[model samples]
Target: MPEVPQPVNDNTIKVRQLSHYQFSWVAGEPGQNGTYTLQLVLDQGAWEEVLTLTADDADALQDLLVNTSVVHYDVERRTLLFGVTPAGE
Candidate 1:
């Protein structure tokens, strides 16, 4: 029998700081979808996470990053704040 797949959970990680990032693109076979991988090193290199996004999604994120003036990874909120000024203005 084939091995069963495990269920995925909706968990969130608080990011205090990001130390590094890398982007990669893999071409899919004929008639297949390619994927973009965004590798992130968080918490001053304490850990890392890789996110796979579709081409459209990756383009959208790139646009946002290009146009945004500020980006914040709020640890307490556990979310990304784009185009919002950081504290202590």
Candidate 2:
């Protein structure tokens, strides 16, 4: 007999795992009023503009997600960097 998978809770639904991810900060054009856009790429295919971060927001986010696999950003140039921390860190 095969055991069926169970949901953790009524509101919890299991879905496909994200195999890979990428993040980047795009600088707004000259007249865009100094706004920055954070973009995310999933599984090397799908694309999503997750959020827009202000200068202060980006700084705070960098500190919060320091333990994650990859983190890269330049405050001056507004360039986004990406890297993956090895497994079992």
Candidate 3:
């Protein structure tokens, strides 16, 4: 058996929401802006804007953020460990 690669400090990660159960965007950078439009694709599907950052710098909609549908993720890790599960039981 193997252990999951847990986030050493998930708190550092920041996410901007767009709507409830709709679209939520996470970014490695800080703050929201017109250039920060989150291009997200849930389950590796089509890409869509989770949060519309335009005009003045504003945060993403809290209701629009979705974590379960993390279609894509660019994680930054210092030391990561990989593993594999048994093919057959």
By TM-score, the best candidate is 1
Poorest lDDT segment (10 consecutive residues) of candidate 2: 10-19
lDDT tens per residue, model 2, 1-89: 97756755422322222234334566568867566544544234332225577878766656645545654443334444445456899
| Residue-by-residue lDDT tens digits, candidate 3, 22-54 | 333345455643244444442234222344554
1-89 in candidate 1: lDDT tens per residue? 98745552223444445556677899899999888987766666665667788888678877866676555465555455576655898
Deviation from native of the Cα of residue 11 in model 1, angstroms:
12
- Between candidates 1 and 2, which one is better according to lDDT? 1
Off by over 4 Å in 3: 1-34, 46-52, 55-58, 66-89
Candidate with top lDDT is 1
Candidate 3 scores a C-alpha RMSD against the true structure in Å of 13.0
lDDT, residue 7, candidate 1? 54
Q: In model 1, where do residues sit more than 4 Å from their true spots?
A: 1-13, 67-79, 87-89
TM-score of each: 0.58, 0.36, 0.21
Give residue 74's lDDT in candidate 1 (0 to 100): 56
